[model samples]
Target: MTARTDGGAAAEPSSGTGRSSSVRRTGRWQGVAAVALLAVAIGVLAKRPPLLLVGAVAGAYTAYPRLTATSDPDLSVRREIDPASPADGERVSVRTTITNEGDAPIADVRIVDGVPAMLSVSDGSPRCATSLLPGGEATISYELRARPGRHVFQPVTALCRDASGSVEVETSIAAASAFECEAAVPDVPLRAPSGHHPGPLVTDEGGEGLEFHSVEEYQRGDPASRIDWRRYARTGELTSMTFRTERLAEVVVCVDARPESYRAADATEPHAVALAADAAGRIGDALFDANHRVGLAGFGRRVCVLPTRGGRDHAGRFHRRLATDPAFGLNPPEPARAAEREGGGAPPRSVTGDGRNGDGADADGTVSIDAQLSRIRAEIGADTQVVLISPLCDDEASRIAQRFESGGTAVTVVSPDVTTAETAGGRLARLERSHRLSGLRNAGVPVVDWTPDQPLGAAMTAIGGRSR
Candidate 1:
């Protein structure tokens, strides 16, 4: 019923007592002895043969514990999980094997595999019980479903028992099984500013800048400070001065975080959505640092938008939204809220009617296909450049990218290839993905083909920032 500390006894050397680790009495011995004594007393009073036989068995069973030595059994445990780095919702098979390495025979051994907390046993159990002799090995196999993030499988719980149920020795076994589920997002690629929305690019035809552009005929209301007074004194003609325009690009970094995007090539790899999300944050950070106004828009079962702004604080806010925006995170919308987001009468979880506000349909859940495109257009205004980060798993991404470009908004597609050619279906899927990207390129959308494992900058550098 309760565990008592062994104090000095636990620390004592095993050689003197012919025992190993300190053991605990399971307390079942006391209950068995009481029952045995009662049966024997009843048998003696009634002189019944059946009762006497039952009492004899009970008494022998009671003696079994006393006959066995209370010592820790010598055992070694090893655990292995196939496909260690499982993607979200993927299943991984795990096997835990324990060996009786010592000469003593273990009557009963229970071994429990340490499954990660973020993972659930989808197919088999985490524990198994068995008996083993010297050199005998018992293996337990199970399957677990993975989620996002890294999870370390805790140490295995091993319990050893002797012939008698009185003594128990407990220990833990750790075989270094760590399962990391999320995809790696190391760097993001960005197109240097050209002619966009106004950050740092100096335009030729400009006015009101620090650097001198050119002198022009002075108008009646020209500012005296801007007038070329030296030229006027030399040639006696009043002329105004002009300077280059620092035009910054209005940029919208779009990330695809749909449930479909949360897929990995197999159980032992990261998912596409994780990669996309990481890239989105990095790109947003870079653009913000470059003094370009950057906004974030997430497309999934729900749409999330954070208005465009240029500052370190806005970068932090973008990172936070990427971390906690429920539309793109593990937690789905609550029921009432989900209803409001999805209901027609309620607002769509799409971009707000006024995209510049950056408060898109205010957590509107998933919208219809047309509504999605409409929201995307609304989120990106005219002359704004859009960088879409996706895995290109579906053709719809290609179509959307092209649609934006055709609508006078320059669209750049940065797709991280997540498909593998391991199987026929995977090969076909990869080919289809290539075709879709090719179609986008043909449609004049600059496609930045990238692999998730590689540095994003390398891929962009290969293209030398040329999107069209």
Candidate 2:
């Protein structure tokens, strides 16, 4: 795996030049003035010239802090992560350089590079402390154990102090950097598929297949090998053996990227949406490898639907869309109005059941979850199955799974277990999640209860075993 350093389409840097309005007193010399006054009083009463000299020195020290004023330091930051694209559990090295752009020397410069919350520093430090003269730079180096997802860097935080250390200024520098790790999924965990095109899935319909379906009266153009020769000899009748029909399946991998799905058991770990996206990518790739038509969708702030298709190019498009689409973004979707107010991209248009243009939004322009489900239902065909990836943190996720299954579409749910027992609320949520998964299973929906602690393959194996 190689990391791409080009500031191209993949690297989406944060907006904003830099923010440095904060300035405050450090109070390093808070009591020095009082000490100076005490020394001066003692010198005047005791009538000692050496004491007076000492007092003068103390007074100068007291004034020294006030002599240098603290202002926001002009600085620039450059960051780079090597082995940008890493394999699962690979360690990536990051280096950041903070340069002082101001003419004056900064006596104390402290920098903290913005590391993605999902990644943890495994080696070295993301922090650096040094004095930077004009045009000087300091580097902060660190190693991160890469996880699956598109992890983006936040703004770099810098703190500058004056020579006396009495005043400090803090600022944030924007730098856009990110990397993605794609999980290797050997096969898509799917139940028996019902599809149209000829492929691996066997259907009840008799056609060309390996599995026996039935035997019927022999007709013209019947293949000689298919004839029931033994039965024909015994009964003076000819019959042709028919086998089950095999067909390729179209699968839509839907990711639950709603705000509710962003929950994580640990703050430092990747959220459920990220995990879902990662799993969805792997599932899509596996389906494509099997010659099955694959599509992508996101039930986020707006309904996103990429109609089912097949090809090597389509696979690449699917992976790129999962990584870059706002619906599957690492951050929760901003409210539609808020996004408009902030001049961000407008919310995507709601899609109809036919995957065409439709207004599924309310007056506030927020697409309802029901509308999103309706759109997905429209995409489902007789031979198409839906693989729903969600955290299952709430009843809505269960509702989605049940809805798809009730519609007569083969549905398999891959739920990332993000619930923890660290708190009372977390414990309750965990219980609720357990109940929800159980309910889904009872409802005849295949549920893969996936915990981040185990590899996705293990969870798929559990699902595969249950599917049998």
Each model's C-alpha lDDT?
A: 0.65, 0.75
lDDT of 2 by residue, 88-170 (tens): 78998888877777788899987777777567678997777899988898989899888666677766767778989888776
TM-score of 1: 0.49
Stretches of model 2 off by over 4 angstroms after superposition? 1-87, 104-133, 136-138, 148-182, 202-206, 211-222, 228-244, 333-363, 379-382, 465-468
Q: Candidate 1 lDDT, tens digit per residue, 352-416?
A: 11122135444453575557667877876565678888788887777778777777777778898
By summed lDDT, the worst window of 10 consecutive residues in model 2 runs over 348-357
Clashes of each: 11, 3
The C-alpha stretches of model 1 lying farther than 4 A from their native spots are 1-198, 201-246, 330-365, 464-468
Candidate with best TM-score: 2
